[model samples]
Target chain A: MFKKKHPLQSKSEILLRNIVVTAMIVFFLVFLIIPIGIAFVGSFHEWNPLSGTYRFLGMENYKEVFTSSLFGRSMINTLIFSVVVIIFRVGLGLGIAYAIYSPFIKYKSFFRAIYYMPIVTPMVAVAFVWKFMYNPQIGTINHLLGLNINWLMNPKTALLAVMIMTIWKDFGYAVVMYCAGLYSLPSDALEAAKVDGANGRQVFLHIILPLLKPMTLFVVITSIISYVQAYVQILIMTEGGPGTSTYLASYIIYDEAFVKYNFGYASALSFVLFVITAVFTWCSFRVSGSEE
Target chain B: MKKKIMLIAMVSALSITSLAGCSSESNKKEQTKIDVPTEVFGDTIKYDPNVEVNNGEKVTIELWEWGSDELFESLIAGYTAIHPNVTIKLVNNPWEDYWTKLPLALDGENGPALFNIHNSYHENLINYLAPLDIPIEDLQADFTGVDAHIIDGKVYYIDYGMMTGTVYYNKDMWEAAGLTEADIPKTWDEMREVAKKLTIKNGDQIVQAGLNFNGDFHQNYLLGLNYQLGENIFKEDGTTPNVNSDTMKQIMQMLVDFYEVDGVGSKDFGEKGADSFGQGQSAMVIQWGHFYNTLNTTWSDINFGVFEIPTFDGNPYAYNRYNGESTFGINKNAPKDQQAVAQDFVKYYLANDNVQVAFNLAMSTFPAKKSLANNEEILKNPSLRVLAEHIDRYIWPGPMPETVENSLKRAGEEVFYNGVDIDTAFDEAQATIEKDMKNSSFVSVENLYKYAK
Candidate 1:
C-alpha cells in the first residue's frame, strides 16, 4: 500500500515537479539569501560603494551602533510606538470585529467594506493626507476643532501624533483579520457555553476569546514585525524630527545607509534590528506554544 | 532514471544562465580613452561651437538635476538643435532624495553622465567628479568666485550663481503697517520695531507672525550671523569647529529673544519660513535668492519684495556667507565617449552669454559671468539686484561639511525645544561636529574668506 502511486505520478510529472521545486529554490537563493549574506559580510567593513573601497573594521561598526546615543533614542522611540499602536489597534479591531459579526448588526458587508478601505489604500497617500490634516494653522483637524497645536513640530506630541495616524491607517487591517477569525470559530462550543449558564459576556470572554488565540497570536506577531520595521510614515510626515522625537530604528538604518552613505554601519544596524525582531517573534511563539 | 537525468540537466542549464546574468562583462572590449585638452580655452585653443562630439557618433547623455528641470530641458533642446546627433536626457529628482540616490546611481554603469553638484555635498562627491580639463586661469578670468572652487589647480565645477539669505517681506503686510521704503530695516533693532508693528494677535494667540524662523534658524540665520559679529564658526584650522563661543551664544540668545523676549515671532507659528510667508500667515521670512522664483511659480498672487539681511549694528565684518549654486559636473566613471560629449555640452553652455543670463534668471541667482553682470534680463529680478549691490559684503566659505550644518541645527533644537541651556547646547554641538570631522574625510578649505573689516 505504501509503494502504490497514483496514475498521474508518471516520469514526466515527477520531472515537472522537480523542475518547479528547483526553480523556487533558485529564486529564493538569488533574491533573498544572497542579499542577506552580502549584508552580513558587509557589516564588518567600512564600505564606500562610490569609490569601490572596503576596509575591514572587525567589530567596530557594531560597537559604534551599540554605544551611539542616537541609536538608543531611536530604539526607545520604536518600542514606544510599536507597543502603543499594537495595544490600541488590536483592541479596537477585535471590538469592531465582534460588533460587526453579531446577527443584530445591519448592513454588515457595507461596514466591513468601509473598514477595509484604508487597508487597501496606499500608505504614502494616507500619510500625506494625515500630514495635511495635522497642519496647525490650516489643517482640517485644527480648523474643525478650533485648536492651535503644532502636531508634527511639537516634540512632546510628535510621537503621539504619529502613533495616532499609524493606528488610524492600520487598524482596518486588524479588523479584517479578526473578522475572519471570528467567522471560523466553532459554533458548537459557543452554543454549549450559552447552554451552560454562560451569558454573552462570559461566552465571549472564555469560549470565543480562548478559541481565537491562534489568530490573535498571528495578528500580534505580524504587527510587531511590521511596526518594528515601520519608517515610511515617519519619513513622509515628521522626517524623524521635531528633533528625533519620532526617530525609529528603521528610520535610523535608512538615514545611515542612504543619507550618510555609511552602508557598513547601516548593515550593522540592520542586523541588530533583525536580531531584535527575531527575539520578539521567538518569544511570541514560545508564549503561544506554551499556552497550547 | 532518464527523466531524472534530463531534469538535472535542465536545472544545470538554468543555473548557468542565471549566474552568467549576475556576472560582470569581462569579455567586452575596453573603451577608448578620449583626449581631454590640458588648456580648453587659450590663445591657440578656443571653444568652437561647431566641434563634433563623440567623433560624430549618435549619443545620448543622461543629465540629472534636483531642480531647474525646465531650464535644463530648454538647454537640452538648444544643444540638440545645434548638434542634431546628440540626445540629452534629463532626469530630475527632488532635493531630499537626490543626494541619497546620486552616489549610488554614479556607482552603477547606467548612471547619468552629467549631474548637478551642491557645495555642501562636494566633499563626499569629490571622488566621483571628473575635474574640468579647462585651464584654471581661463575659469578665473571668465567666472566670478571660481577661486573658492579650485582645488589643487583643478576646478571640478564652477559656481554659475551666488546666493545668500535675504529678507522677503509681504508687500501688502508692509503697506498695511504703514511702512515705506524709508522704514525698511537696516539694523536688527529697526527690524524688530517694524516687526512689532506688523504682528497681529487674537487674544493671546498669534494669528499672524511678523517674522518666523521656525525651521530655518540653522541654515539661514545662525550660520550667517556669526560673520556679522566679527567671528567665524570654525577655528582657524577650519576643520575644528568653534561654535561654543561668546559670539555664538549672543546669536543664539538673539534668536531666542525673537520669540521669547521680543514677541516678534513664535516657534509654533508655522512649519517653515517660506511656506508661512507664501500663505500670508507670515509677514516676513528669511529665505535664499531661489525663493524669488518659488514665489513667482508657487504663489504668484502673493505680492512680495526683497531686502538685504539686516546687520547687527549697521556695520560688520561681513553681512553673510554665500553658497555657490554650482553647475553640473561630468561623471568620471561614465564611458569615455559620454564624458567627452558631456564636457563639450558644458563648454557650449558656458560659452553662450544668452544661455548664462537665462540660467541665472531661471534660478534667481546672481550670474557668475562678469560679462553678464549688466545684462538687462538678469538685472530684472529684484532679488538679484539686491544681491548685486551687496555681493562684495558676502563671503564664500567654500564647501562646508554637512556635519557642521547638522550639529548647528541640533544645537538650535536642543535650546529651543529641549529646554537645554545655550552653553550646554553649543558645547554638545561642538563636540559632535569635532567627532564627525575626525571620523570623516572632510578637510576644510582654509582662507576661503577674509573676515577682517
Candidate 2:
C-alpha cells in the first residue's frame, strides 16, 4: 500500500535523481570533504612543501609531534591552559549564576549585560585589548600591582595570562548555560535540603551541584573544543612568542600554512589536532553518559 | 489562485535578481580600482606610459601589488592607453601580512598571475618561481637583477627596483647640536659624539633619542658591520652557521655596546623603531631610501637632511641590514602572451629611463638597474645617490635564515629591552634557530646554491 501510494520510481527517474544528487554531492566532496580527508591522510606522510614531493611514512608525524620538544611543550601549554580555564570559568560561572539566581541581587540585567560583553566581543579585539593590559612594562595590571611581570612575553606567566583572558571572555556563556540548569532544578529539592538543616554551602554541594552536572558537561565539552581550536588569542596576544613558549597546536598549524608556506606540514598537524579533539570529545561524552 | 501563485514566484525572483545584481556590482568595484600611498621620494620621475601589450592579446592579468598599487594603476592607465588590449588589476595589503598570505595564494591553484616577493624570502619561494627562461647573458644585461633572480641555475625573480639603507637625519635636531649636513659624521665614533650632543635628558627618562637603534636588529646593526669587517656570516658554501664565531661575537658586542654601554636607544623611551623617524623621537636613524621619501610625504616641512649611513669600527662602508627588497617572477601557469608582456614590462620598468624616473617619482624608491643608479639625474638626486655606494655589501642577510628571523626575536626582546646579557640572548637565538632548522626541511644557503649557474 505504501509503495503504491509513493509510486515506486522507474529506473530513469532513479537515474535522474541520482545524477542530480551525485552532481551536488561531488561538488561538496571535492570542495569540503576532500580537503578535510586529505588533511587526515597527510598526517601519515612526510611531505616537503617546497619540493612538492611526498613520502608516505606512517605514524612518523605522530611520533615526531609526540617526541619533539616544541610540539610537546605546546601540548603541555595547551592542556594546562585548558584545564585552568575550565576550572576558573566553570567555577566563576556557577558563582555568578548562583549569585544572580538569588532574589536579592540588584541590577541583575545590568550585571548580565556586563557579563555578556566579553562573549559578544570579537576574539581578536578582546585579545588585543588584553595584550596591552598584560604588557610587561606598561600594562595597567603590572603598574597597579607594582609587580614586575612580563605577562605576555615571559614563558612562565604567558600561558596563565592567556588562560585568564580566555576564562574572562568565555565564562559568560557557561554562566548562561548554568542559569538554564539552575532554573530547571526542582525547587522542592532546595526546600527539602533547607528543611533538613542544610546551610547554603551544604545545599550547594549536596543538592545544586548534582543537578548542574548535565550543564557542566555541556559547558566543559564545548569549552574543551574551543580551547583546542584556540588560535586567535595566541595570534593576537603573543603570536606564540618568547621562544615558542605559548605556541599552541592551532597557531602552529596556522603559522605553518600561512607564515611558513608549509601547507603539507600544516595539514598534517591539523589532522593530529582533529584526532585529539575527536578522542577528547568522545571521552567527555562517555564520562558524562550515566550522569545525564 | 493561479495568478496569486505566479505573482508570489515573480516577487521572489525579482528580489533574488536585485540581490545578485547588488553583489555583482560590488565585485566589479572591488576588481577594478585600488588606491595606495607611497613614501615620498624627493625626486619625481615620469609615469609609466602603458602596460606592455603585444599583438593585441587583450590580456587581463591578476596582480598582487602590495603597496604603491594606485600609482602603478595610474602608470598602467598610461600604459593601457598605448596598448588597450592589456588590463592590469592590482591588489595590495599591509607589508607584514602580505608576506604571510601572498605566498600561500601564489602557490595555490587559483592565485594571482603575477605577485611580489621580497629579498628576505628569496630562498623560500625558489621552487614555486616559474623560470623567466631568459638566457644568462640577456638576463640582467644591464645589471637589473640578473644575478639577484638566478637560483639553482634558473632565473626565478627580478627586483622591482632597489634602494640601500641611508642615514636620513633630522636637520632640526642636528642643528641644535651645531652640526650641519656638511659636518655629518662618517664613522660610528663621530656619529656617537654627535649623538651624545643631540641626546637630551630631562631627569632620568630619555626625552629624545639621539639615534634609534632597532633592537634585535641583528642583521642591520651587526651583520652589516660584520660584512664590512670582512666576515661572512654564512660560509660561501652556506651550510655551517659561523654564528658562534669570534667575529660574530665581536659584531654582536658592538651592537650590544651601542644600546647598553653607549646607551643611545632607550627601553624607557618606548618609541617604536618604524615610527621614531617621522615622529621626531630620534635625531638620526638609518633606514632605506624610502625614509626620505616617507619624510617628504608625512613630514615635508620638518627640517631634515639626508646623508650616507656611517661606517662602524672603521670599516669605511656601513652596511644597513637589507630589508624591503622585492623580486618579480612570472606565474608558471599563466598564458604565454602574459609572460612575454610581463618580461617586457619588467625590462622596460628597469631599463627605460622614463619608467625609472616614474618609479622614483611615484614610489620614492630607486630604479634597481645599475644604469639608473649611475645616471647623473638619479645620482645628482640627493636621497638615492649615497645609498648606491653601499650596494656592494647589500645582502638579504642570507634570505632571512629560518634559524634567526625573529620568531625567537621576541624572546630575546627582554634582554635588549631590559638589559639582559648579550651572551644569554644570543644563546637563546642560537637555540631557537637550531631547533627551527632541525624541524625545517629546506637546505642551508650553502647547499641551496650547489646548482648555481
Candidate 3:
C-alpha cells in the first residue's frame, strides 16, 4: 500500500482467467440472451414449426397481441394475482421474519424450516394438494369450514385460491431473506432509537424498517418477477378456467404458443410481458434509491 | 510419474476393452431376415400374426395412448412373443398432457413411432401423420368412423374404438324414484322431469344428483342437443363460429336449467360429475361407452342401463355425437424400417382378436371394427351392446376447433359455477369462440364439411 505496487500474474494464469470469464459470458449470451433475442425477432414473424416456415409479419403480430381480448384479461388477472401474492408474501414474510429474528423467540431454525417446507416442495405437487384441499365436497377446507363452496370452480374465488397457493409456495423465500436482513440490521441505530425515548414500534419503523430497504427491494422485485411469470399453479389448480377467471398473462402466452400453435403472437405477448417486467424492475430500483 | 502414466494407460485400455465388449455383446446377439406374408385379415386388413419381421432386429415401437395400459401391455407382450424382433413400447401420457406434448414431440427425431390423438385435434396433426398402409376403401369397409381419419383424400389415422354419448342411468336410483326402463325419458322435457325425480336432496344438500350436469363433456352434450334441434353450432366452414343462434341459446338454456332451475346438478359436482354417477351419488350421466368400464370396476354392485340421449320435443331421432377413441397414427418422420414395423404392429394390434376383446373389456370403448362388435364377450354386456349398436349413428361434427368446444364448456362452467345467466354465458362464449375461430390456424368451416363427407 505504501509503494502502490501491483502484483503480477503469469501469462498462462491470466489467459486461464480470461478463458473462464469469456466462457461464462459466451454461455450466458448463447443460452439466455440469444433465445430472448430470437423471441423478440420472431415476434414479428409467423412461426410454423411443422412446415418449418417463418414469414415476416412486421407489426401485425404485435398489433394482434395488443388487440387480443384474452391477452388483456390475462394481464389484468396477472396484475391482481401478483399484487395479492406480494401483499401476503411481504406482509407475512416481514412479520414472521421479525418475530423469529427477535430475541424473545426460541427454536428459530425449527420455525424457519417449518415455514420453508412449502418452498422446497414441487409447485405441481403443492398445486395438486391445494387443489384437492379446495375441492368443494370432500376437501379439507370445505369439511373444516362446514361450507360447500366450490373454491376452484367458482369464478370469484378461483384466482384467489390459486394466489393463496402461489403465496404459500413462494413466501418462504421472502421470510428467509427478511430474516437474514433482520439479523444483519444495524443494532446500534435501533438501540439509539430505543434509548431516545422510542418504543419498539418506533425503533422498528424509524430505524429497522429504513435499514431493511435493500432487502425489501430484493424481496419485492424477485417476488413480483416470480408472480408475474406464474403459469403452472394456475394450469394445475384451475386450468385458467371457470370462464378464464384465473387466466394469467403467462398462462395465455403458453396457451397461444403451445395449445393454439400461435407462436408469433405468443412471442409478441412474451415481449410485452418482458417489457412490463423490465419497467417494473427499473421503477423498483429508482424508488428504492439506496444501494451498497 | 512413469508409474502414474502406466496406471492411466492401463485404465484407459480397460475402459475401451469393456466398451468394445458391451458393443460386441449388443451386435452379436442374433440376426435373421424374415419375409412378411401377404395374408389378409377379414378381407380388410393385410395382417398375419406370424408374419415374419427382421428377426432379432430389436425395434422398439413406442405407442403414446391415453387410456389404461393393462390391455396395451398384454397386447405388446403378445406381439413381442409372436415377432421377437419387435419390442412395442407403450408411452401412456394422460389425455391432456398427451395432446400438449405430442405436437412438440413430433418436431423431434425421437418421437414415438405411433401415437393416439383425439379426433378434435386431428386437423392440427394431419401434416405430421403417416398415411395408414391399408387402402382407404378397405379401412372404410371394416372401421366405423373411418371418415374422421381422412385428410386430403388419404386416411392417416385409424380408431381402435369409438364412443357415442348416451344416457347411462343407475337402475337402482331409477327404481328408487319409482320409475322403470319403460318410463325412460324420450324427450328433453321428460329427461328433465326424470332427472328431477331421480335426484335426492337432504336439507339444501344433494345426496344424489338426478343428472350430474357439470362441465365434463358439456360441449359434446350441447352439440348433440343442438343437432337434435337441427342447428349446427359452427358454420358449414368449421372455423366460423355459428353458436350465436336461437337453437344454440335453447340448448344452453336447457344446460343452465339443469343446474339452476331443475337443480339436477351443481357446481359442487365440478369435474367429479362422472365420479358421482359411478359412486351412485348421481342417478344418471350422459357419457360415452367408457362409463361402462368405470362403473363396472368402481361400482360393480350398482345396476345400470344405457339409453340414447333423449331428442328434442319434435325431433324424430336422438342425435348421438360420438368421438373416436384409441385413435392412432404412425409418425411420418420415423425411420423407414421402424415405420414399417410400426405399421405391422398396428395391423397386428387391430387384427388380433385377443387385443380387440381385451381392449374393449378394459376401456369399455366399443371396437372400431364391426366384426368385433358381435363377439359374445361384448354382446353379453347390455350397456356395451347398446352403445355398439349405435356405432353407425355416431355423428361427425365437422372439423370443429377444440377452442369452440372449450369455449362452450366454459359457458357451461359460467352458468353452473358462477351462476351467470344462460343468455349472458352464451353471448360471452359466442364472442370468445368467434375470436378464437378468427385467429385459429384451422381451415374454413366449408373444408370441414367437405372433409366430414
Candidate 4:
C-alpha cells in the first residue's frame, strides 16, 4: 500500500537517516551513558580523584550512606520539600491558569508573562534575593509584615522558607504548561456543560480536571524529579545550616562529592537518589492511571 | 545498503577518534618529564634567582585564587615585566566555590599551574602540590611560619601571613555609649558589661546589638576561647577530636549566655556578625584580621577600632589560635614548562620586599617575612599593629581540617537554633569530626603550642 521510491533517491535518504541516527547515538553515549556507567562502577570503590587513590570495597560506601544520620536526615528533608512544593506549585499553577483562561479575564497574555518571569530567571539569583528577603533584621518580608521572625536561621522555619522560595520560583513553570493545556482543551465539552446548566464549580470538578489529567501528571512527575534534585537554593541560602535543617539528599551528595571529596560515596548516594526518583515517578504514573 | 554500512563505520570511527584524543592527552601527561629537583629528606635544593626557566620560551602560567584579583594582577604585571618570556593568568573564584572547584580542577589535565592554598584543605591537596626547591635555612631565617608547612625536607608553600581573631568595634558607637580608650575590655566579664551598656533595644527586638557573635562562633570565638581556657579542640594526636571536653562545654555555655542571658546579641539579629557590624547595626564584632580589609573595602565609612580579643581571665596559655595565609602551591600535574615558570614566580614573589609588604598589607595580616615585620607598610595598618603586639600570645594550630570547623559550627547552631543541650550538641560534633577524620590524612604538628607559656 506504500508508495515506492526510486533506487538512487532511497539510497540517499537512507544514508542521511543513518548518519543522523549514528550521530545521536554517539552524542548520548559520550555525554550521558558513559558518565552513568562510570558512576555505577565508581560507587563500589573508595575514590579520591585529587589524591589519585582508589580502592575496591564492595558496598561499603552504600553501607556508610545508609548508616549515617545526616544522610537519613537529608532524605527526610528532601522528601518533605518535594511533597510540599509539588502540591502548592501544581495547585496554585492550575488555579492561576484557569483564572487566566476564563473568557471574562482580560490581559491574559500579560498575566501569563508576569507569572512566567520567575521560571526563566536564574535559580541562583532568585535564591539570593529570597535569602535577603528572609533576613530578620533588614529583609523586606519581616519589615513589611512587622514581624521579628528569623525565617532562614531558625531550625523550625529554615526548610519551610526554602520550600516556599522553591515553590515561588517553580510554580511559574507549571503555570505556563497548564496555560498551554487549557488553550488546547476541547470547547465542545465545556459548552455542553454550560448548556446543561452546570455550575462553574461542577464543570471544573467533573469535566475540566479529568481532561487535564495528562498535563497534571506530566507536571507532577517532572516536579517530583526536579524537586528531589533541588540543591542550588539550599547551597546558596543556607548551606544546609541551622544544624542541617535544610539538608536535602542532593545537597548531601554535593557535600560528599565536592566539599568532603568522597566521590565514591557521593556516587553511591546519587544512585540511591536515582532509584528513589524512579520509584516516585512510577508511583506517580500508576496513581494517575497513565501506566499503560 | 553499502552507504548505510559506510555511515555506521564512519560514526564508529569518529567516536573512537574522540575517545582516543582524550586517552592520548593523558598519555602525553604520563610521558612528560617531571623536571622538579629530587632531594632526600633533610636535604634542600638551593634556589637560584638567575636560573633560566623554560629556556626563555614564551609560556603562560595560570594562577588560581579565591579573591584578590586586583592584587594578583599588579603582582603578575610586575613579574611579567621582569621576565618578559612568561605570562601569568589569574583565575579567581569566590571563596566558597574555590575549595570545591580547586580539587576537581587539579585532578584534570587543564588545571592551573599555580593556585593559592588554604591550610584548612592543605592535607587533601598535598599530593597534587610540587615541593619548593628553596633552601630550608633561608626559609627558616626569612619566614616566621615556614616550620609548619615543611614536610620532610620538602616545602609545599610557606605561610605568607598570620591571622587570628580580634575585637573590632565602631568608634562612633563606642563614644556614643560614653566609652573611652580605657573602656576597651581586657577580660570577658568587662567586655560583656561594656556590651550590655552599648546594646540598644526596641521592646523585645534588638535594633542595635552591642556585640554580635551569631554566625561567627566557630571561626572567630570558639577557638580563641578554647585557647584562653588552655585547651585544644583536638587531642594531641589531632586526628581524634575532643570538642566535647569540659573546657569546650564551658566555652559553649559562655557563648550561649552571651545571647540568651546577657541579651547583648540575638541569634537572628543579622545574617552574620561581620555584615551586622559593617551595616552599623552592631557596636562590636569578633572577626579575624582579614575582616579589617573587608571592612575597609566594603564599608569604608565606618570608623572602627581594633583591640586584642578579650581573654577569660587576665593571663592564659594563649589568647587565640592562629592559622596561616599560605602562599601559592605549584601544581605537580601542570606541564613541565609551566611548572618551571611557576617555581620561578614563587622565587620572585618571596625575594621582592615590595611585593611582600603589599601582600601583607592587602591581606591585613602579620607578615610571615621577619624583615617585613617592621616594614613601614605593615606597621601602618592599625589592625596589623594590634595583631603584631599579641602575636606571640597566639598559637599556630597546625593545618585544621574543614571537618573541625564545620562540626563546631553545626554544634553552635544546634545549641542556638534547636535548643539542643550543650553536652549533646558537643558530643555530636565530636562524633562527626572523628568520623570525618577517619577518611582524612590530617595530622597535628607536635608542640605547636609548646612556646605559649
lDDT of 2 by residue, B1-453 (tens): 323322322332232222333454543343243222122111222123333357676788777767754345545543454566878777787886776566566677656666777656654556556776456565546544445445677766655555656676778888887977677888878887877777777775566778776533543454555555555555555544445456656765665676667777664343245466577777877666666656766666667777776776555432544443464656666666777766655543443344445455344456665556676646655677766665555544345554465633543454554355666656655655564555443333322221221
User: Where is model 2 chain A poorest over a 10-residue stretch in terms of lDDT?
Assistant: A1-10
- TM-score of the second chain in each model? 0.86, 0.77, 0.81, 0.86
Of the pair 1 and 4, which is ahead by lDDT?
A: 4
Error of 1 at A48 (Å): 2.9
Instruction: Quote the true-contact fraction of every model.
Output: 0.30, 0.16, 0.44, 0.79
Residue B93 lDDT, candidate 3, scale 0-100: 87
DockQ of each: 0.29, 0.19, 0.44, 0.51
Candidate 1 lDDT for residue A156: 88
Model 1's number of clashes is: 0
1 against 2, candidate with superior DockQ? 1
Off by over 4 Å in 1: A1-8, A290-292, B1-46, B55-57, B450-453
In angstroms, the error of model 2 at B24 is: 20
Candidate 3, which CAPRI tier? acceptable
Q: What are the interface RMSDs of all the models?
A: 2.0, 4.7, 2.5, 1.5
TM-score per prediction, in order, is 0.90, 0.78, 0.87, 0.90
Give the distance in Å from residue B175's predicted Cα in candidate 1 to where it truly belongs.
1.4
